[model samples]
Target: MPEAVAVDPVCVAGVDGCKAGWVAVFRWVGSNRASEVQIFPHFADLLASEHEPRKIAVDMPIGLPQRIGSNGRGPEKAVRPLLGMRQSTVFSIPARAAIYCEDYREACSAALAHSTPPKKVSKQAFHIFPKIREIDQLMTPELETRVYEVHPEVAFWRLNGQEPIAIPKKVKGSSYPAGLDARRDLLVQFGFVANFLDQKPPKGAARDDLMDAAVNAVIAERLLNGDAEPFPTDFGRDERGLRMAIWA
Candidate 1:
């Protein structure tokens, strides 16, 4: 008999901070099923949770090239000469890759097609790239230290927004996809993902959990494919070690 290789377990988490609730789906790598569904009070809870993630894939921005709009000082100013005349989010390395990638484009397009208000859906999806950069720029070192240290809250806020952080109730439940049908389209992509994991295409409709799992799965795919890297510094080596990457 030949020896069998063991599949390493990878835990995947998907975070969606909706208008009235935040939903998270955690899945183990070896199986096609999610290990848990965590509905938290707010986005902070998702970040502060005691659970340790071996390989995290957050659907958020990780970094932004600093000095884009700095006071035309220091290294930022010098880099401009090297970067040429044009600099925008769309042209940034990460954004360019994310927007053009076949899977992400298809997934985003599918989301728009299903949405009732395609414009709004398209706007939000389109914002992810620049927002990642924006958040990284807007978040202060002091605030970052107080909350996440170097945890990449910038990316989190870019995807979920700071509103959820301020107004916890806005994103706290089951009826997350109530009136916004277009936004629901984003959820639909997740549904397709869950079905794919289950080895069955979506029959007719899928649950929000399935959709969340799908998003997590996409993040997982990106991390393995080297779309992102882990943050350099550790927040602290505690019972809950620092998250290496926002999307890893």
Candidate 2:
């Protein structure tokens, strides 16, 4: 008899930023089960971890532009109308120069200077600047071949047969149970087991964060199977030649 051999499971990840850090859900290839759930304080650390997922679908903006056009970084503009009411979840990312600024006011100033007819950074967009900057700093054309920019609402829109979710996952900054259940039901239809969907979120992550990450994992599986499509079919590139397109 041959000695037992260890085999590493082929996997992909869906990541969402949380209050504590990044919450990543690892799903095995060719299956719906999530093999692991983790929270990493830094994006780089997740990359360097042992899992080495074949693809990473993250709910963060990538491919920052040097100059902005009327509709934001192209991907956001392309996907917004598809999302209907859920479109608000996609924030308009400003120029790379603006994202590097240490202060919110400075970032707004940079955005105004770099955008056409001038635009100011929204407080909501400003809040996620840190996570955006984190991925931007590490992204390269080579790395981007595996890491993809994804928006949970956009993913959900795709999951829900191209229809925008009828409910908002959050209302007035509080999680809505009905909305969460609505999404969970959709995930179930798409092959996720109820046990995984109902599991308590790891520390530092909210229930919504975990769900968002889980949906991203679904997109990751799509990407791996070559079943996913990018918004703005033509896509865009940042100064460093990183591709900018939201995948679903």
Candidate 3:
């Protein structure tokens, strides 16, 4: 790879895993126009070739635990009640060991071995295992300090003045609308440039992916500004010492 060019110092970013790899949104401080909104095939490639933002909020769980509670981690547990009807969007991150398993059967077996009560590995979580493991392996002390875990719904709820949006992101009828416009409107009001949301999503970037990434960028801004809130202020770290808190 060529030498990475430096990005704006005031830039903040959000990343969402996409079918093609990752979709990201970058925004500079004090302006509505986004610096970038695109997809990259690998998380590391995105960071290396793309302009480096000061902080990046990503819609992925970090800090996998060996054991799970009745409801899961405090941050994961806290979100369901807060999201109300839209809670299922959040997938539980399984034990760190389960991520290394190659198949669902192996993953399930591994989950049981690692947890006291044993956890059933979901097909959804299994599908994202590759992406999760990618982040888990790539994270280091220096990178962990800059990148953080965030949930789109949590970030959106926070953006809607601490209220969840009434519309579901993936609507069942009428072209399967993801209510991207509704989210865009709210984000615009929150301070994003109006035109950025108007841009068509690139190929393989689902509407939800774009919206999710955008909110994460906003969270990055609030995080540095000391205005963001973390779930389960009392949190723990992963085996490698990665923080388990979810910021919104």
**Winning model by lDDT:** 2
Deviation from native of the Cα of residue 179 in model 1, angstroms: 13
Model 2 agreement with the true structure over 71-167: per-residue lDDT tens digits: 7798999999998778888888899999998799999999999999799999999999999989988999999768999999999999998998989
lDDT of each: 0.37, 0.90, 0.81
TM-score of each: 0.34, 0.94, 0.89
Ranking by TM-score: 2, 3, 1
- Candidate with the greatest TM-score versus the true structure: 2
Name the TM-score of candidate 2.
0.94
Alpha-carbon runs more than 4 Å astray in model 3: 1-9, 31-33, 172-178
- lDDT per residue for candidate 1 within 1-248, as digits (tens), equals 99999887665555543333445556565566545656655555655666544434444433332112212212222222322222111122222223332455663554444333431124444544443433344444433322221111222222342211122111343324442232233334533343333332133223543443445544544454455333332311212222213332
**lDDT value for candidate 1?**
0.37
RMSD of 1: 16.1
The residue-level lDDT of candidate 3 at 109 comes to 91
Candidate achieving higher TM-score, 1 or 2: 2
- What ranges in model 1 sit over 4 Å off? 1-5, 42-44, 47-51, 59-213, 225-248
Task: Please identify which of the two predictions, 2 or 3, would achieve the higher lDDT against the true structure.
Answer: 2
